[model samples]
Target: MKIEVTHPEPKPGEPVGAQYWRSLDEYADRPEFKEWMHREFPQGASELDGVNRRHFLKIMAASFAVAGVGLTGCRRPESYILPFSKQPEGSIPGLPVYFSSSMPDGWDNLPLVVETHQHRPTHLEGNPLYQPYGSGLTAQASASVLDLYDPDRMTSSYRGTRRITSAQVRDLLQETADKFAPTRGQGLRFW
Candidate 1:
């Protein structure tokens, strides 16, 4: 549950580097490093200068007992189970079915081969019918499916200080277009 605050967020597909160590023997390939790597652990790890096997086991058992009691006192998570009244004749539960589809991209439509599970679209890929004989999908087309389930995407429009419906936004845009009709946008500059 603890986080290392100093580590930066990694890029999406970047490979991680090896772990850093303080000792030079650990860094360079050394006999001591190999010995440490093959060290017999847990068997004698708890048997330090004072603590013996039985003493360690007793401490561990007590710790586990306390932990188990503490966990039981905490609230158990709630789970839900919903069963369908009737199953479909041909369709099998939990099996995915693929459907050919396409999404608009400017003037063109990118083909999609979507995987649907129990009538729900689960994943998608570029239609194998197009490009390099269905070799791969463009990054834009591949990433577009994520937009379908995006929770943070804007669902409404706002005008100035007030929330406005989509229709009102369209009307306002039209009114502005009319006002700027003959001017050819000479007075306004888009940043």
Candidate 2:
């Protein structure tokens, strides 16, 4: 059904105030305007003429089942855990071991308990058994173990522009020790 619409014209002497009319359709007050107001959406927007919701859902479910079956062979391979054939003397996989140690500071020593995991020193704490030094570690002593794994630390000795082996460095140290032995470490300065 078609409805006719007409636009209202204001008189020459009257002014078109702000509250005169909201919209042209409302001012015209046609049957088509009332039908448009009663609808939830515009024409052809809410119309599902071809495939209804039930058929659409069944097609989606079948597509999902086929896709799932095709992806079954694409799963990750299974991984197995194996135990070590022969374990090392004092190394364990997860547990840490603690050993009593001392940190030398000038004339005295600070008692410490060194914690090691897989034979590698991981942490250091104060020894409570030693009464002379209280059960608290100095900041310097606590952080000293971390220097063992520092990335920038020198891994090998160097003499001038040439790389030196451990044996060469040991020989040079023995020579220094022999020279200082006569003086009883008098002239040998340690920083």
Name the candidate that leads on lDDT. 2
Model 2 over residues 86-163: C-alpha lDDT tens digits?
Answer: 887776789998899888867678899999986799999999999776778889989999999999988899988788
In model 2, the runs with Cα more than 4 Å from the true position are 1-86, 158-163, 172-191
Q: How well does candidate 1 match the true structure in TM-score terms? A: 0.37
Candidate 1: lDDT over CA atoms? 0.76
lDDT of 1 at 49: 71
lDDT of 1 by residue, 88-191 (tens): 66567778888888777665667789987777776878887787537366678777777867999867787676889988988987887888888976675322
lDDT of 2 at 172: 89
Which clashing pairs does model 2 show?
none
